[model samples]
Target: MNIIETNLNFGNLTKRSRTVRAILHHSAGSKASAEDIHRWHLANGWAGAGYHFLVRKDGSVYRLRPEWAVGAHASGSNSDSIGICFEGNFMTESMPTAQKQAGKELVAWVKKKYGFTKVQAHRDVQATGCPGTNFPFAEIANGSTGTVTPTPPTSGNTYTVQKGDTLTAIAKKYNTTVDALAKASGITDPNKIHVGQTIVIKGAAEKPKPTKPNGNTGTNPIIRDGQIHARNFAMPGLGADGIRGPRTKEAGIRVLQQAMNRDYGAGLALDGIWGRKSEKALGRHTVRRGEKQYMVTALQILLMLKGYYCNGVDGHFGAGCEKAVRQYQADHGLTVDGIAGYNTFKSLIQ
Candidate 1:
């Protein structure tokens, strides 16, 4: 969450009158630094580095434009929105964990500082598919992406560099590598550790996967009971054979249709078909935790189809359902708030 100041000067910049939301975007190309962006934007005959902040692939945040200045990133919303750009093209590439984590922290910090909750993709206000389809918008927007493991106690996990203690010796004592220690401690030179410098001693932690009902640790499978529940939603082609397969996965549409009919008073028949009626009936209802409704059932079914099981396809948004939703969101690059809303529904159903 550190914002690195830049010495690059811009020609002409206007101070913004208000700040509303954060508009997220990707550079649409790989390997560009803040200086590069500033030069490119200057070449575009405008202010330097149209974005307010540029987050690098190595989790470094650089201040591109002054926070109070209006940016030229977005179309018409530049006057009221702060633009934050990432350093990679998200359309064809997945974001690195460090970059994603840094983006999440930057977005959360900006939201807290500006007292705003609205986080929009570049395409949300423009006609282009910006920020890319592969960007983890949901996780970053909701600030739901987390560290793999809890940070250990400082006394146990950190070491104060003694006058005679070398990084190799400290790493050996901590059972880690010099490279990992250097990366964690932001040490540029392995041979450079002065006295009184405290270094964190930990390895890279991997994200934990949700445990399935069958005691597996990888992708959660759609249980036969989920298929059975889908069959109850009047899903055609399901023979109630207690077997989960492709047909069972497709039956999620029926679950959504049934939920809409029961919960939203949509007059469509529960034929388990995705059509105009189902699409139109899906209002802007964002379902989150602490709710007991048919929409939750639909969300559970959709998630289960995607190999993320939520304990059961029950109409409850409990911890399991939330976790499943977050995992699904992380996979699909959606907002990771564990809430099923218009975008989540569209991504699931469509």
Candidate 2:
């Protein structure tokens, strides 16, 4: 069994191109790897993962859609560019510490690798709240122009969703218009937008879109590769229903922990190693746990002890575990299925 897996095989790499222009930042609603992002784009019907690369919360980087493969990450600009999506949603909040540095490093790497003239945020090119308010997209782009070090987006430039952030108010702050922002985001009503929802104040430049009568708006364009979609991309290697819930997290955590204990001799920390500590330990612990489910059973025990659950420890899952699962599900906005699947496990231990 492989200690680590990669969907991107340079063997089947798409031919290199010189037209790579900009890098777009996006959120996965949580932290994810470039491999995970690649899986997500494939699920979204994209050729591979929409991003050319991905940066994890801990700054780990993985190549997703190769530079030559057309990516569906950006609208009206898939044919001749590279798309980069950092895993966590930067809107409504700050990204994890590791991811923040990782984001900067990845951007710099892409610029050097491709000689991209410009670096733009997903919001800058399209009317959306992607790349979030807190992300330093503008600074990234500006710094790329001449500075050696990356700069942060200007202060007071971020706007947290408030009880009442009227379109007019938002426009005034960014010197933009409500209608333009709404149209870019595909929103029907400005008032209907909710608190904590991210919106782009700096609008995107319109690219030449594929034209057809009532032409496909290409808002959710995905390539059908008979794989999974981002909306359903919680677990891939592990057969699962595509939601990113607690089960997924829990399972993922266990998989990582077992991998760590094998080589390390002693599993110093039982935590899923979602961060740097366990990642290093995993190298020392490379022994496989025989079966995936058995590894998950270990994770279940940890979850129950956290008081996040009261599920009894059992080799086979029981209703006691199921009920605790349901409570955990409800608290974290899961499907409430008694079965402990990918999404359920992820949320449970993460």
Candidate that would win on TM-score = 1
lDDT of 1 at 112: 61
Which regions of candidate 1 deviate over 4 angstroms? 144-350
lDDT value, candidate 2, whole model: 0.49
lDDT of 2 by residue, 37-141 (tens): 656656766566666666666544555654446667668766677777767777766667655655665566456645666777777677788888777675555
Clashing pairs in 1: 138-334, 138-335, 138-336, 139-336, 254-272
Clashes of each: 5, 40
For candidate 1, write residues 1-350 as lDDT tens digits.
Answer: 34555678987888687887999999997888999999999999997889999988987777788765799999899999999999998999899998998899888867765679999999999999899999999999988443222211122235667889998987766555788777665566779776645566523112223444664422223544566667776575575433334466468777887888888888887765677887789867778889999999888877655545687867889978876776556445575566788888777754
Q: What lDDT would each prediction earn against the true structure?
A: 0.73, 0.49
Worst 10 contiguous positions by lDDT, candidate 1? 147-156
Q: Listing every candidate in turn, what is its Cα RMSD in Å to the true structure after a full C-alpha superposition?
A: 17.1, 20.1
| TM-score per candidate, chains pooled | 0.44, 0.37
